[model samples]
Structures are given as C-alpha cells and as structure tokens.
Target: MDQVALLQISSALLLNVGFIWLVGSWFARRWLGSSGVKRNDVEPALRKLDLVAAGVSAVASVVALYAATAVMGGISLQEAGPMFWMMLSTTHYGHIGCLTILAMMILFAIRVRGGTSGASDTASLLTIVAFAITRASMGHAGENGILSVSLAAEVVHFFSIGLWTGAVIVSAYFVLTPQRVATLALAVTDRYLNVMSRGVMLAVILIIGTGLYNAWHRIGTVEQLTRSSYGLTLLVKIALVACAIGLGGYNKFFGLPAAGRSARGVAVVRRVLQIESVLLLGALAAAAILTSQQPPTAI
Candidate 1:
C-alpha cells in the first residue's frame, strides 16, 4: 500500500482500537463493582488503559484530518493544511471530517479530566456518530442520489462496528490482558459475559442489515458480485465478518460457561478472544480495501 492507503488503514485500526478502549472501559465499570468486586479494587487495571482512550482519539484527529486531505483530495501532507482549509470550507466530506475531528478532540479533553459520567458517555456516543458521518460522506454512500437512506445505513453500520469492537475489547481486557488476578478475572468475566454477548448480538444484526442494504444498492445482482472487484472484495469482507460473529458466538455460548467451570476453560476463552480480536482486525482491513475498490456500476 502507498502512504495514503497505509494512513487510511491505520486510521481505521486506530479508530476501532480507541473506540474499544473508550467505551469498553466504560461498560466494564459496571462489572467492576458487581460480583462482590469493589470499584476501587479494579481501579488499577482500568487506570492503566485510561490514557489510551483519549490519547488515541487525539492521534485520530490529526490522522483523520490529514487523511481526508491526502486520500480524498490528492494533496500532499505538508501542503494539505491550506488545501484542507479550502476543502473544509468548500466541500461536503471535508466539513463532516472537521466536525468529526472536533468531536474527537472534545472527547479527548473530557477523558483528560478523568470524566466518566453518563454525560461523557453520551458525548462519546455523539462523537462516534459524527465519526460515522465522516465515514458516510467519503465512501460509496456519499455518491448516492437518494442519499438520505444510504447515509443513514452507513451510519448504522459504522455505529454497529464501533459497538462490536468495544464489546470484544471488554471481553478481551478481563480474560486476556496480562497481570494475573485469576480469581478476580474469572469473577468479572463471568459477571459481564451476558451484557457483552447481548450487545455484540445486537451490533451484529445492525451491521448485517445495513451492510446488505449497501451491498444490494452497489452491486445489484449475484453475477455482479462475482464479476466485479468491489463486490468480490465485499464478499470476502462479509465472510471475515461472519468469522468474527461466529467466534463471538463460540465464546459466549461455548467458552464463557466453560471458563466459569475450570481453569482449562479460562485458557480456552483467552485463546478464543485472541482469535476473535484478530478476526475483527481482518474484517476492518477488508472494509478499508472495499472503500477503494470500484463497483461494477462505476465501471
């Protein structure tokens, strides 16, 4: 990949990882105090990753801003600042991306103050919505004549993706992260499994429904799916997404209960989580690739 593509994929990776850190840790707080665990008890674990959420968002602002200028506008990174200003004032995606970057920075500021109120979470959710708008404005969804439905679907899909990524991280942090607190880890993991599972299940449904809507609009037919590069890559992305969903299912239904029963099951759950996180990254990479590919109709 070139610098532009690398930056695009990096932006995706950072966005997902940071989204997971920001929201997963928030939800993890619920499990932190329950199951006979005190809020202060697990504060150390949470504290360690606390800086990550805001730090990454701070980075994302710069990356997303430069990325919009470079990838969409064909401007060099250095010269892109003035061009970015011109585009931001003149173009659609540029406007949304600037707003998204602003939202990101606002969330980052909240995080710096160690804020964790419902208000902060609400702000985070809204910022994520702006980020989704940035996404919708740049992709095939932005090209649609009937743009309202398409943009809405893209937003839904993006939100679901962010939610699922965070859900997976919630599971991964308790079960897979280093620092041995075996009994405590097991307790918290067991406590939050249901919430994580249900959230992920809902996200999967939204992702699928919105994804299908976009795919149908873009590709139009079965033959086009095989004949066109965009559709073919999309199929691969869908398969990878299915793999991620299947892994989550296996962990929730098969692995978590087993983990609760014995140490061996805990190890299995850890491995399952490792695989699942990797699969999610693969799916995201495929999505980044999908954005760059031309649909059959375009050809």
Candidate 2:
C-alpha cells in the first residue's frame, strides 16, 4: 500500500481502538459496580486510561481529516497543504470530518474533566455516540444523505463492533486480570460474566445483520466479490470476523461457564479473549483497506 493507505489504516485502527477502550471502560465500571464490585478499587486507573484513549482518538481524528483531504485532492501530504483549507471549507466530506473531530474533542474534554457522577458519564457516552455517528457519516453511507438507511445501518454496525470487540479487549487486558479476578467475590465475578456474555451475544446478532446489508449494498454480485479489490478485501474481513465470532462463541458457551466456577477458568477465558481480540483487530485492518478501495457497486 501507499503512504496514504498506510496513514488511513493507522488512523482507522487508532480511532477504533480508542473508541473501543472508552466504551469498554464505561461498561466495565457500570457492570462491575452493579454486580457489587467496589468502584473505588478500579475507577481511578480506568479513568486515567480513558483519558489517554480519548487523547489518542482525538489525534487520530485529526489525522483522518487531513488524510481524507489529501485523498480527495489526489496529492501528497506536502503538496496537499495549500488545498487543505479549500477542501475543509467547501466539501461535504470535509464538513462531516470536522464534525467528527469536534465530537472527539468534546469526548476528550469530558474524559479530562473526570467525575464518576451520572451526569458526567452520560455526557461522555453521548459525546462518544456522536463521534461514532459523525465518523460513520463520512464515507459511502454519507453519499446517501444523513437520513438514509445506509447511514443508519453503518451506525448500528459501528456500535455493534464497538460493543463486542471493545468488551473483549477491555476484559482480557484490563478488567479480568488474575489479581482483580481473585479479589472479586464469586458472586460478583459470575454476575459480571453473565452480563458481558449476554451483551456480546446481542452485539454479534446485530453485527451479522448489518454486515450483510453493507456487503450486499456494496458488492451486489458474486462476480464482484471475487473480481474486485474492494470485494476481495471485504471477503477477507468477513473471514476474520467469522473467526472472531467463533472464538467469542466458545468463550460465551463454554469458557464463561467455566469461569463462573473457578479463578483458573477466568485465566483461560481471558487468554481466549485476547486471541479473539487479535482476530477482531485484523478485521478492522481489512476494513481500513476496504475504505481505501472503490467499491464494486460504485463502478
């Protein structure tokens, strides 16, 4: 891939990871606290991590905005400088890009002004949702207008991915650590796992539904799926997603039940979650590459 493609992938990966982290943190605190875990034990560390993720996401949004401009103008980064302002001021893509950046900035501000208060949490969630919507509005979906079914499907798809992948990432690397799991009461651990299992199942259902709509809308035929660059990348993405889902299924059906029984089970489940997350990340990379290609239907 070229520099622009690489930049797009980096920006997409960073933004998605950051968004997932924030969402996962939010869910972890809420679910764990509801399950009778002590919020004070985990809140401070999670808050700090959330802020860092927000900052990285904000930077990624800026990078994405510039990358979009450069791509639109068909110019190298340096040469694109002069046309940047023109693109920003005049194009629909630029308008949506600016809105996306604004949403991320707002989310960052909310995270920085940290409080465990319900109002603060609600603001953070709303801002992140707005960020997702604006980001979704910037690509093929945006071409159909804000009120279109395409845009709605894309938004739903984005959120489903966030819920599933983000939860796995946060659970594996942050929340379900050996130390933390050992500290939690058995009841609390079981409740948290149950809630997460249900949530992941719901997310997977939505992901499949929206994913099919998106693929059909973009590719339209089996021939395009095999012949076009965008279609082929999409097939790879679908395969990765299928693999991730398979792992998630194992965790939900078997690993989670085992986890509810013992601490060792939790460790095993966390390892599987980590593997699942890697697959999900690969899917995200494939998605980034898909965005850089022209969809077969667009031809």
Candidate 3:
C-alpha cells in the first residue's frame, strides 16, 4: 500500500482497462452488428470510454516512470528528478516505458480523430498491442534478454490474462448494460457469448501453460512458494485466477446455452461476469504486488 505499489497497480489496471475497452468494442461492433444493430449506435460511447481509459493510462505511465526511476536510483523523488532524463535516455526499461507512453498517446489520437472505418479499428488495435508488448518487455522478462523464453512466456501470459479477464471486465461493466442486452436479439447475444466463450477457453489454455512456466521460472521450489513474499503473492494470484476460471467454465458450459433461450438468462450471465471480473481484478492487484517483490529464485 505504499506509493510505488499503488502506482504499479493503478498503471496495470488502467493499461488493461484501456486495452480491454478498445478490443471489446471491436468485438461487439464486428459480431453484434450482424444482429441488426448498427455499429453507430454504440461506437461513439465506446470510443469515448476508450479515450478516457487511454488518457488515464498515459498519466499513470508517466507517474510510474518517475517512481521507477526513484527506486532504481535509490533516491528520493526530488533527487530522482535530476536522474530521470539520464535513465530515460540510457536504460532499456526507460526505453520500453517511453514506447508504452507513446502507444497510449497514439491510441488517444486515433480515438480522438474518430472514424468508424475498419482501418481506424485496425490501427487502434495495433497501437494497443504495442502498448501491451512494451509494458511486458519492461518487466522481469526483459532481464532475461529480448529473445529469451522467459520473455516470450511472460508476453504470452500477459496477453492471455488480458483476453480472458480483461474481456470480462469490459463486458460486465461497459458492453453488457441492461438496456443494451434488451436491445440485442437473443440470437445476437448467444453468438457473442459463444464467441467469447471460445476465446476465453483459448486464453485459459495459454494462461495455464505460460503461467506454470512463469511460476517455475520465478519461484523455483515448493519451499519458496510458502516462504517468499513474491511466492505468497503469486499463490494469492493463482487462487484468484482459479476461482475466476471456475466461474468462466460455468458460464461457458451453462450460461451461454441458457442465455440463448431467454433475456433473463442473459442477465444471469452478466451478473456472473461481474463477479468474475472482480476476482480477476483482485488477481491483478496481487500481480502488481508480486512485481514489487524480489523473487526467491533471484535470491
């Protein structure tokens, strides 16, 4: 609950929220539009939300950079100010942080200029992907070198988390409003949920695969999992993720089919999604804490 930890959590949450909004918006427009609702009906609101998320994420990135510089140099914030330019110009972490900020700015610009074209959506998606990649690269993954398996596993793991948990966050809070649910045809709702379920299944698979690799690579032993702060936070994260996955499985197996049958069913699915999103956010907060700790393996 210190400043650095708070900033890390804020930055992680904001970055993922921005990524989710844009990606979810694209999915909704692309698939839901086939059900007779024009994309224009939702595009403006979604775009506005995307822009807001990007703006907050950009600001958080700047603040995080200052904090990281202070920590890296073992200096006070005021003292760190003098070293900030040097770090920004000289370090790999600083370079990735700059790229993350740049990507956020590009996303802001793309949304601000506002067109409903496929090209614009594609550009926005690419920018967000770049932002995710740079953010991942700035983590412990980067310590292993750009081409190492550690970095590759971490990048894949990060994307899987976003696709699974982040998607649910957007769906529960933004995309699946009661009004919007009522407007969407049963078939449309079913199709969207089916597609999402499939995507979530895929994400879960990748998450499990890469998560095991990351856990093994970082913690190294059963003793570490119980003994180290990093491992303990990671245990909490894994528990949260496991609960979220259980909820997701229920939705995929039961919720989607039920949703196809009635409006009430769709509402039930949304409620479950809301709960799942909360669990995922808790896991994300644990991850932020993990990042601030030294791994037992490193010790």
Residues 175-290 of candidate 2: C-alpha lDDT, one tens digit per residue: 88888887888778889888987888898999999999998999999999999988889989999999998998898889988988888888889999999999999998888777
Report the CA-based lDDT of candidate 1 relative to the real structure: 0.70
Task: State the lDDT at 159 in candidate 1.
Answer: 75
- What is the TM-score (0 to 1) of candidate 1? 0.84
Q: TM-score for candidate 3, please give it.
A: 0.94
TM-score pick, better of 1 and 3: 3
Candidate 3, superposed: residue stretches over 4 Å from native: 34-36
The candidate that achieves the highest lDDT relative to the unseen native structure: 2
Full ranking by TM-score: 2, 3, 1
lDDT of 1 by residue, 1-299 (tens): 67776776677667656765655666566644554566665555664565666568657656766776776677666667667677677887666666666766776665566654668667756765676676566677877632588878987887788778766766675634545336465666566666567777888899989989988888989999998778788888888888888888898789888977766676787778778878887887787777656777667
Best by TM-score: 2
Clashing pairs in 2: none
Off by over 4 Å in 1: 31-37, 42-50, 71-82, 143-147, 174-188, 297-299
Report the lDDT tens digits of candidate 3 across residue range 1-299: 66655665666666666665665665656655655567888888888887888888788788778878877986666678888888888998888899989998998999899998889989987887787778888888778887889888888888778778767876787667898887777887788777777777898999999999988988899999998888888999999999999999899889888999998888889999999988988888788777777888887
